[model samples]
Target: MARNRTRAPSSTTTTATKTQTVRINGARVKITTKAGKVTTKPALPLEWELQAAQVASLRRLPQYQRQFLLAGDMNASKRGPRAQAQAIATGMTSGEPDLRIYGEYGRLLMIENKVGQGRLSPAQKDRHAALQRLGYTVLVIRATTTTEAAEQAVTAVLEWLAQEKGKAA
Candidate 1:
């Protein structure tokens, strides 16, 4: 059982807004939230939702696959401390990507989706580097424009396809 711990707003923080701007990985990102919504600039939208739509659209394409698995790698939840600890003890490993698209020929694409000026945490950076070292295709993407995020995913898959074809030949 996780502990329900909510910190009261400090003097520097405002109560009107749900999020505060802060720099992470050289990118300005909104921190914390209210009403379950991010209060930030218009540069980036909700990332998870955008990733969902992009994955769905890609799934319909034959190039992606007739049927594929899109696994959402959720890192956090609204659970309390105890539950959070329990989760970590179970399978909630640090630095996992947001989405895992298992493609053909055992190819895997790990996408870390970010919205607004959001950036990766230290653990995320470490994970990304580790995955890259292990010969995995990892992408840290921010969904800003209409098709930028999806386009990135497409490009990654295309590159992977080419690499796989080369291996077969």
Candidate 2:
């Protein structure tokens, strides 16, 4: 019979170790690492960061104005002849007018608003023509609500439109 032989097992056991490190401007930063995971703290609050970005964007525009226009079923038809004529003949494809006025004789008036400092560019004139072609008299009003300036621009536009309509009639 042959003598039995036995071998002793090694005492080492396999285990996973995780290492964590942080960096700041090319220098190693202190970071707590555990279970092979790492995370960094945010430097600024999200809300504050977003507000700062928005303010920066708004500052780029020197003048800002909002235009309101008449709302009608005809305005809703994007493919209609009136809409096409307005866009092709007068450049006002967008159906928004600054204000809409109804006259005693069933006439309609459209107003476009702009800031007082805003100049009437060629593009703006084109838009005005577009609104006129749609049979809605167009006018541009300065941006102000003070007593001296309040509503004067709109009044002037109305008078002009009335005169034009009278001439046409």
Candidate 3:
């Protein structure tokens, strides 16, 4: 029988720890690996975080309570394939703005919320254009953090309402 030769495993094996940043929920999250195990943590505020802040701030305003509305079938999209298809069939249009505010005299403002380097998708652009053509005002609000986004959105809404108020007066 031929002699079998097997090399022994190295005693000094190096386990390299790797780190990387990835985008999750529109937030930058850091992922680290150690000894073949992985860990992830958010490095920035998520888009939903900003949106929730905006919603909370807007809801606090008495005037906003009645006029503010959250649009889009985002929940349906998250539910699964059947729900998405059903939503589409039931007139859930794509690229709808995340929020809408109805002002006096039938004026409207649509808000597209974004975080970080987010930009309008092609479908969003088209939908916004259509709304504009129908005499609606659309605003794209973007910020890196939740605090900034809420403040910016509130300020913009108040200013627009002020302008509308001025026009009426």
Best candidate, TM-score: 3
Model 3 clashing residue pairs (backbone): none
* Model 2 weakest 10-residue run by lDDT: 64-73
Cα lDDT for residue 156, model 3?
88
**TM-score of candidate 1 relative to the true fold:** 0.64
lDDT of 3: 0.79
On lDDT, the stronger of 1 and 3 is: 3
Better of 2 and 3 by lDDT: 3
Q: Can you rank all candidates by TM-score, best first? A: 3, 1, 2
**lDDT of residue 67 for candidate 3:** 47
RMSD of 2: 20.4
Across residues 1-169, which tens digit of lDDT does each residue of candidate 2 receive?
9989887886864344444445578554445445555655422222222223323332333321211122322222347777688665864444354445444345666545444455655665776677687776776555432322334533453465456568667
List the candidates' TM-scores in order: 0.64, 0.32, 0.72
**Model 3: per-residue Cα lDDT at residue 164:** 85
lDDT of 3 by residue, 29-129 (tens): 98999888999987767667777888888878877656444442253136577987887899878788877777777787888877778888889889989
Off by more than 4 A, model 1: 1-43, 64-68
- TM-score, cand. 2 vs. native: 0.32
